[model samples]
Target: MDLNISNIIIASLGLVGAMIGGFLSYKASKSATQDSIKAQSEIYNKTRELENRRIFENKRTSAKIIYIDFLNAIDEGLNIVKEQKRQHVGRAPNLLPMNTAYSSIIVSLSEELNPEELSVINRLYGIMEKVRHDILNLDYILGTYDHIEFDYRILLVEVFGNNYKEMIETNLEYITRDLIVEKIDREYKKVFEKLRVLGELNTYGN
Candidate 1:
């Protein structure tokens, strides 16, 4: 029997080379898979961040619109007194719009709202309820026959000489300007502070 050390060494070398190749291939495949997973995770994070920003922006826009509408309604509410003095004016004399606007602003960014903001909102709701009660009392006095329309409002001032309707208007203006509007300003500033801060931070990046 002839023993060939060269051939044996060559065969051993070939087996080691194949083993090394397989190990390297496995490592390369694992690295590629890890890279793919990392890329997907980054993409998911970016997408989630963008979605969050979109939601925040939407909330901000909704808050702005509701606030503007409430301001307009407040203007209308406060103007009811002046409107009573006028002989003829467009739109009726009612706090319904303001009430509706206030209701609409119940909670847009509730998470961003502090206790003070919530308190002010409750106070404003209370004031609105008082205003509603006054209106109902007036409606009862009027017998709800024709409803509290514009003509009735004007007629009350003409006949009563700014007694009933004008008195209510004056009262509404006082409470709204003093309590409701004041608290609204204070609480709105505080409530929206976090939103503003987050918005500024988002401007940079995640």
Candidate 2:
């Protein structure tokens, strides 16, 4: 009976040990799973951060290019205006190319841009549109009545007269090429300042 009791005791001890081992194993597995989940969460957050940075950089780079291109277009348009004045005749070519660049800027980073930047850029575009429309109007007049005989000045007076020229002058004075360029420089400086602060402009060349 003592021997049997000893065997029974040994079996019970073995069973209890097995149960204890199983509990520890379960706890270890749970801890490992929690650690794995935590690691994945951290990795996901880092990935998201990297993605956001990339997108912001792309927008900034695009904005820089657009700003430069638009300024160059303004320069070209100014040259055209000077040429028109020197020649004293001929219709101005459209400034539509600059307008297109502005459109691209709006599409790419409209939401990202500060409200004041948006307003200034849009106002610049509006001025360009007016200039383009005027150029087109002049082209239409020249095309439609090129054969008319008279001094170009007299012909213009006869065709469009004081009212049209006065209106055109007013529009031109309000949004002169110099004014457009000045505004662009001012607004671009502000934008670049912000980009510099954010360190967004540094990544542009690469």
Candidate 3:
């Protein structure tokens, strides 16, 4: 029970020490919490970037596959036309028009497409659509006229001469051996090269 100045000083020092320790503990805990939040934010950002890249890759692969398929179909159709022209008699060959995959794929990835790519795809799509429409119109025209078992296209060619195949050539030149085919082939090559440069190359060989 010695209430001297030394005892009072010791008690005061102990209180100050406890307060400083408590403040330091609070500061450490706050700093740790902030660091954890920052780390979580960084992880979230990285995850988003990875997901975006994956989506872009998938779209690119899909576009390449679709484009190549359409190109193959065009080649096949031209070959069919050539074969039919050489060997066909009586009935006209049924030439199925190309699908709308070109437009569909382009629309799906519209957000990431550059202006040149977009323009190229749109032009190609337009050509495809116009060709499709022309084929349908030709079918209608042939349907209206009655003829023998001969191929309606051959009949039309005989009836119309050079003017008859104008639309067909414009639409079919991409896949045919006609003189116009070279120009269309060059256009396709330009577009495909651009796609390759954009990192949208397909797994399938050219």
Worst 10 residues of 2 by lDDT: 147-156
lDDT digits (tens) for residues 55-80 of candidate 3:
87767765665456445434433444
User: Considering only N, C-alpha and C atoms within 3 Å, which residue pairs clash in candidate 1?
Assistant: none
For candidate 1, write residues 1-206 as lDDT tens digits.
13588788889999999999999999999999999999999999999999998878866655554444334444444455444433453434554444354444456556766667656555544544554555656644335423344333442232233234444445543544324333333335454344345344321111
Model 1, clash count? 0
Could you tell me the lDDT of residue 37 within candidate 3? Answer: 100
Positional deviation of residue 37's Cα in model 3 after best superposition, in angstroms: 2.4
TM-score of each: 0.54, 0.55, 0.55
Ranking by TM-score: 3, 2, 1
How close is each model in CA RMSD to the real structure? Answer: 9.5, 9.6, 7.9
Model 1, residue 32: C-alpha shift (Å): 1.4
lDDT of 1: 0.51
Which stretches in model 2 have alpha-carbon errors above 4 Å?
84-113, 129-206
What lDDT is reached at residue 134 by model 2? Answer: 51
Cα misplacement distance, residue 96 of candidate 3 (Å): 5.6
Q: What's the C-alpha lDDT at position 152 in model 2?
A: 27
Tens-place lDDT per residue, model 2, 37-105, is 999999999999999989777677666665554444454453453334435445434434543555665
lDDT for residue 70 in candidate 1, whole number 0-100:
39
Alpha carbon lDDT of residue 103, candidate 2? 68
Which clashing pairs does model 3 show? 90-149, 90-150, 90-151, 92-151
